[model samples]
Target: MDQAVCCYRHPDRETGIRCTRCDKPICPECMVNASVGFHCRDCVNQRGGTHVQPRTIAGGSVTSDPFLITKILIGLNVLVFVLELALGDRIVDDFGLYAKCVDLQTLQPARCGVSDGEWYRVLTSAFIHERPSPVHIGFNMLSLWWIGAPLEQRLGRSRYIALYFVSALGASAAVLVIAPGALTIGASGAIFGLFGATAVYMRRMRYDMRPVIALLVLNIIFSFTWANVSWQGHLGGLLTGTVLAIGMLYAPRERRNLVQWGTCAAVLLVTLAVSAIAVSQVTS
Candidate 1:
């Protein structure tokens, strides 16, 4: 076997230094010693040509910015939990702190607080949780992180964020129809959407579905076991995620943008319509 070439900057030179860039064998002439290893001129030029490096995880798949958006969401959840904790006994009686939507009497949008005009609670309630317990927030945030990060990395920031919010709204829309008087909070709906997305993504990508399918089953089982969990929200999120993922990943490649958007819009409208009918009877 030929001996490994030395990586020093000399043509005839031989030593056991490795090239940091490209990992090609570099006899001394080509070696430019850097902190990690000797690099060749071509490697340096290539690195320079690509001004911005793509971020990658250890296995080399591209990853999104880990700290900025994902961590910001986590931080907000934690901060809200802390604030809820600090309020102590006052938190229990205050309706303003928690998110509520819909008037019990009119079945229309109403203030979450005692007033009758705060319709924003329909969206705002997503950010809040029912209990102030650290464990509740911890579990929800952890679930979001676990499911959200991989998705953001794969789908890019904006699309992934849209997936989250839309799926959540779908879940809330379902909950509004199914259980209006029940105060629902936490990121579970969004988390369920991720599961739905993951399943569709894996199927579209031709990845193994065993792991993802198992997770879906376990979560559904857990929802049944746990008293406070919203089965409606979870089910709604899962269906929404499946439908959205189909639109995003498997919609006809030949279709124009407007056509695709219109298809998704029509599906979403039907979903909301069904949810509204469900909520009307249940919340009443």
Candidate 2:
């Protein structure tokens, strides 16, 4: 047999393992585990790419299947819509978000009794939409598909999900504060949150932001101009997503994961606090 090859980085050491991809000798220090076998540092990095590959929470290269999470989210929305259609007003009455501050004294007790103090409505409402209005669900899901894949890839799975729910809560809180007597439903708040996050993240990455900015402006205008649109929900989710993105994108590299989680928690707590105050005001 020919003389054993030594690691490229460590000439003094001989290794039996060769990189699975490049077939180069790699010492323990230079070896990176792959699905098939060990790989050299160079080969691993090459496969992962030098630029444009997003990093995960643990700082490893993000190589998960693209748009996996986005697909699941869309699937969930569609499933819920189908269930709502079959169940009719029963689903809407139980799941749709109603203003906690609705004057029950003036309304029929049976109608208003279940509306107040239903905290779960804040989250469940996001999954339900007004029946017979395919336009509402259609536009929201389309926007989600447009932005969710890229944002999920950049932020990784955990952070992306966290940003979504927090932003949804923020929207619910806004509805309580700004329009506590109005019935609200739909994922527009979470979708708006994704939009805001994408806009901020793209700006930080030095990517062209005009398209995002224009979309945001047009959406804001549409929220205000369109009858029955909840501008408060849109604004609340947008602000929350933007703030969370700022924390995630600008955090110190030394402690990035900690800062990102902490920022999300802080935003969630503040939103809950605001919601609590609003509920108290309504009940009082």
Candidate 3:
């Protein structure tokens, strides 16, 4: 009588099955179903194995709906605009970005501004726009869809959201430094950040730069030329986004996530520091 072949894993247990990939005798417990045949744990856990999940360019998870985050952002901006219109100027007064502002009508004390401990205005102000100008929100939303959608798709949701938030805060900080006490509203700054990032990403991929360059130039000119526009916000957001995109896109593959997210944290901290200093200048 011939002796039975023992499983490589369980030497005591006799088995007829073998790992299709490595051709080693395996027990039933060690078998993993594959398209062609069974695979062992070692084969499945290898670098090019089925267990490995796909990753985005910036080390984000490859999502089924790449544009979901961009859509959500647009929805939030629209919702805030509607609330501003329905609830009156109180929304603007409370959320609008300013180093120092007062109730122009009442003239008693400005309920809004960074000086009075309303630091949240740094980010909230990006969502509110001029109530009388329907064009304000309209232009911003269109630009957002154009620039934000593709950027969000490439960078993925978490990285994209971080960029938007930090850019908005950076815009408020610049407003504090450049035009302190000036009331700034609209999503122009955040949208400008998207423009800057898109331009950088195009350059990284060696795409034609003429279109984004032209658009950025035209917008920059308009920001300075147009009355009631916050040029300071635009400038700040552009600088921040450009720097962040470089960090996210060029990170080393081995430590990509750590480097990319760390860059975001560093930029955010610097913006907060600048904002704090600006606030101190006003208060002191």
How does each model score on lDDT? 0.62, 0.78, 0.81
Mind giving the per-residue lDDT tens digits that candidate 2 earns over 83-193? 888988777778887754333577643434113667888888888877776888898889889998778876777788888889899998898888877788899998889
Which candidate should be chosen as best, given TM-score against the real structure? Answer: 3
The pairs that clash in candidate 3 are 102-110
- Candidate 3 residue lDDT tens string, 1-284: 54567768788756555677899876545556554445666777773666744344566665788788888888998999889879998898778887878666877556557888888889899999887668888889988998998788778789999888888887888988888878888788888888888888877655557888999999999989998888999999998888788888788766778998999999999999999998899877
Among these predictions, the greatest lDDT belongs to: 3
- TM-score per candidate: 0.65, 0.78, 0.80
Task: Give candidates' CA RMSD values in order.
Answer: 11.0, 10.7, 13.4
Worst 10 residues of 2 by lDDT: 51-60
Better of 1 and 2 by lDDT: 2
Model 1: colliding residue pairs: 6-15, 8-28, 9-28, 10-28, 10-29, 11-29, 177-279, 178-279
Candidate 1 ranges with C-alpha deviation above 4 Å:
1-67, 88-117, 254-284
Candidate 1 lDDT tens digits, 15-91 = 44346767765543344435444466677677664333332111112333543566777887677666667776344
Report the Cα lDDT for candidate 1: 0.62
